[model samples]
Target: MRRERVRRPSGAVPPSPFVRRGRPAGAQQDTEADPARAGTMGSKQIAQETFDEAVQENITEFEMEPEEAVREAVLQFESQGVDLSNIVKAVRPPASENGQRQKHQILLTLESLAGAVAERDAARLPQPLAALAAQCREQLALRCLAGRHGAYPAVLSACQLAAGDRQLLLQALAALAALLDGQPDLLDAAGRELLLRSLREQQDAEVTLAGIRCVRHACLKHEHNRQAFVQGGVLPVLTGAIARHGSAAELVRTAASALRVMTFDDDIRVPFGHAHDHAKMIVLENDGLRVLIEAAKAFTDNSAVLSELCATLSRLSVRNEFCQEIVDLGGLNFMVTLLADCMEHPDVVRQVLGAIRAVAGNDDVKDAIVEAGATELIVLAISHHLGQPQICEQGCAALCMLALRKPENCSVIMEGGGALAALQAMRAHPREVAVQKQACMLIRNLVSRSRELCGPILALGAEGLIAEARAAHRDCDDVARAALRDLGCKVELRELWTGQKGGLAQ
Candidate 1:
């Protein structure tokens, strides 16, 4: 027959102060404490029975540590035949402090829950880890808004309990981060102050990365935290992470995201306005742009990485201060180089175009891009996406930005065969009313600046121009009506007033 051994610790004690159940069935020799009850054996027996019942009912609740609870919850999730949607909730003591439930208790419960979900054993997770993530997200939002119950440590611990299950944990952390991002005031002054300091002090890359992820979400959700981030030296730490720990993709991405978030804030941007020189000097000192440029260059074949890097660059390109830094880091040259090499990836091309438009606003920069042969590429992209109005619009805007300041380069545009393409794009794709609109807008830009610039567009044959406008007028788009209005009287009146002898059309 199989035998089971009871595994009680040698020094373990029973629940009640009135009755001691530690003694084995017959080992109760310490009867001196109950002087009056020493002789009354039935009373101790009755009290011991009640204590055993209470202990059995509340076994898991009063015995487990917060972290351990988190682990158990995750384990339960990983256990066989567990239903995640229906997590077993543990009962705790009623709220005693300030008439409100304590955050630590809630945190412990959640920690246990997250731990159970993160457990890797092939037992079917009771509910999709997504559900737990959702709950944590909701709790995080509550905590951020007005709960003093839990702090970042609690959230951080819960996330840690989810370690090893990167995907689910990432989502959970992201949701929590999003809430914190929305509510920076949720962090106490000490928490706010420690955000960067602790990150700097931590030698572990993972810890630092996690902190950055938190900051990224916080900045994404709150404007005040954004300022706090900048003040707390988030950029410097991010730069450090990128440079020293490039191998940690999450860290790299998180750091990049932090920079991206900072760049999105107008309040953040405005403070460093015309300090382009100073910004350039400070940022360039650490080779910040070089770091970002390297990330962009290395991620050429990685679409996901490319998209993220491009997003980061797009954000960085917005501030003139940062823009100057980009230029100093050879970003203009690097992007122009990428445009030359990777024109096939449309998304990458789109990002390149945006970055170009951002920094090339200056005269010297525009001239440099033209000298470097960017106009042909820009014009080509515009031509290729003639059917995609938005891309064409960006292309045209870029072209206008390029040539508007440098009318001398009008010939470069025309020489590159951009004029005919632009005019044809305007005329051929009436289905994309917006594209047609942009085409006309570009034609207007060309004509408004230089009448000679009209020669190439006019060379597309006047018949097509009038037909295109007429077709636009007949279309359903309001943009079509505006195109007709701009082209009809605007072009013909100029021709007639100039006595150029080009009536409506032959």
Candidate 2:
């Protein structure tokens, strides 16, 4: 299966807690006093009527010009605690020439919101500011907002200041996550520190989930950020979240995905990456294997969370001992059972096969998996999902690993119709390079040790499929040819140049 990044749903912003309050008793009484001003107390009409009255008064009573009247009206509203931030205080321009003006207006609004967040003593965001922040759900808007001076720091400061209020804190963290989604460089030192602090200190599930998402986005494909986070002890925070919130499916899923991203070396800007080192750190220092395995027990029925946990386990199984550690912790049995139970879910089956394939890297684990009756289940899954190239590929690759060095396991695979399942996969996904290659390797490994099984496998039309794979994909050349040769079929073994003592071969 392809490793996909965990993404928030589109247009998903935190819920705003700042609702418009109803008119106060005094304002209602004022509205009641004048029937002409009815229902205008707390609506937009109130602001317009109030502004027009002030402007008219300024012109008639103070003998002010039109521009002076407008200025005086704005000042009067400001003095009366009316928010004119979103109001157009100048003369209206024609629509044809208003593009740049509209852009400037938007930037001004964003700046006002950011300034509100930056205030240290501000207890909570007002309705307009909170809603505006939530509107930054797209990349362009995020980039635009992030470009403004102090935008990132403002959101981070809001998170810090709103620590006492759960609703306000969630809004700020969600806004912060959106701001840092694809812009990893925007996470400066203070932003990074604030994110770590939030993850470490926050106990609310919603806040923790949002903070974990921020960590994932901040560290994705950014070598410097990944290393910094690891050094700052992010591994424990992630594992601890998993341990603490095993019942919270979304929390476990996001935290597991965050852990998986830490093992990625996908950044192109850096020549060499620390993916292997980070995986080792997660396994050795953080007890990741145990944590994840134990956490998986709580999510037996949740396919999405189980898929994430399984994929993460596959990523962390780098070393032989790590693979063995999974078995020692009873992870192998859990995966096998999960596969059998979730066979109907192609996604879960694919990830379980991958995790099993990863742990089968150890020789002993190979025998143990077979002993656990995985061979039959694997072939059954492959036969069940032949049309899904991901499932077929993972299944075939998994059987290939199980049959790598053990002839006894090869016998078991052949007995369970493993060869037939692989052939079906090859035929099902002819254009899929990974499926074709893995099937070819499975055929080669199956007959590599047991020559007697060659006739039965070749009888299932393995030769033509092998040759077809060899003809179709360049990557399947060696494996396909080896499978052909080992099945006692004639293959043209290419000899480019003879290693003659002289110089060249004609």
Candidate 3:
């Protein structure tokens, strides 16, 4: 028989306080103090007798006699009303003869249980399976903590290599995900190499998709996984997935999601909006933008994938150089069309708006946005999310970014009612710092260059918006003052807010 795997630390299998049973007998747990124990021996003896009867009854079927019986028994564990604790107690009595294969047998049971769970209905997992899963997960975590390099490959070889084993693969992936949920450290060098290797070299879409899901779980909001993925060259695989799986929405979604995670740590500058130049340049060099845009267009029906793709585009568009590239690749038009088609998903709209906000930073990209019917889209978006502070903030920022220093674009803004929307948002939500700032920024951009823009700016009640902003937010007041100075109307602004008469004529 294969040497028994090392035992987990005491209490490791149960792992949490919620478990009552279903742990491997190998995991020795400390007994808990009873809160309501009666001093009556009669009740205690009767409880013990009932338990004995239950154990004796389950012992017959819990026998792992023929290997096929073992498989059949685990598969039946879910369907029959067999108490999982009973199953363990009945079978564990033969430890001297069975201890060698106890852990292995449990693993097989879990593996089979996972397949059954996936292949069967999944609304609610049975209690036994859940408890057993927790035990297996805790056991694997203990192994990972020991720095056992073989643990990862063991899980991988068992499930990932089983071709056409969808249910087995799903369980294996779930186990890997559970192991690394908040424990990025468990992904040591060898484990990282194995995961990265799988992502890079796997030809099977199922394997690659699972690998990327693991990558998403690992890298999402975790700094360690991001660096490991980047260092291990996971990008080519991500882009390659997008390239090959143009039709498979899930594959595209997973790949795009992974790529989005990889670019998360681009915030190199503090108190500033821009990321490191190299962050977006890497995506540009890797042809990620085109790949993502293509995938997004192809899978327009897949909201999750499309949303991540838009977010990735927005992230990449943070720098001006990438902004130009996004424009060159017709990304602006894609976003406009996407927003027009899919307005029901707020997340999708939010990301698309964020990308537009970033892209509009390039004054040159402003014309493309206009040509792509972006102004109408923003007007609709603001209308869609009227009371939502971030949407209004982002819409105002995009409008102001697009309105700055472009004479015709100012007319476009005015005609599109984009300026009216920003002023209204400012009045509607004066307390939101982001809204006030973006409103002020938009107003500042509007009145900065064109003397003609001032008539429309003043007509939109911007003077009153400025006065209210001055009292509500100091930064907004500062920007409003700058906007007044830019428009040669600070004196009017001061007079209006001070309640003084003889403010300069509009």
lDDT of each: 0.55, 0.79, 0.63
Among the numbered candidates, top lDDT falls to 2
Model 3 TM-score on a 0 to 1 scale: 0.64
Which is the winner by lDDT between candidate 1 and candidate 3?
3
TM-score for each candidate, following the candidate numbering = 0.55, 0.76, 0.64
How many residue pairs collide in each prediction? 19, 0, 0
By TM-score, the best candidate is 2
Error of 1 at 148 (Å): 13
Q: Which stretches of candidate 1 lie over 4 Å from their true place?
A: 1-131, 134-175, 178-194, 247-250, 266-287, 294-300, 303-328, 420-441, 459-506
| TM-score of model 1 (CA atoms) | 0.55
lDDT of 2 by residue, 46-157 (tens): 2333344445545555666778767866765565455453333543221355444223333454677666765655654654346545555543433443344456766777
Q: In what order do the candidates fall by lDDT, top score first?
A: 2, 3, 1
Runs off by more than 4 Å, candidate 2: 1-100, 104-109, 118-151, 496-498, 501-506
Cα lDDT tens digits, model 1, 8-67, are 344554432222122233323221222112223333222222222223223343354544
For candidate 3, give the lDDT of residue 171: 54
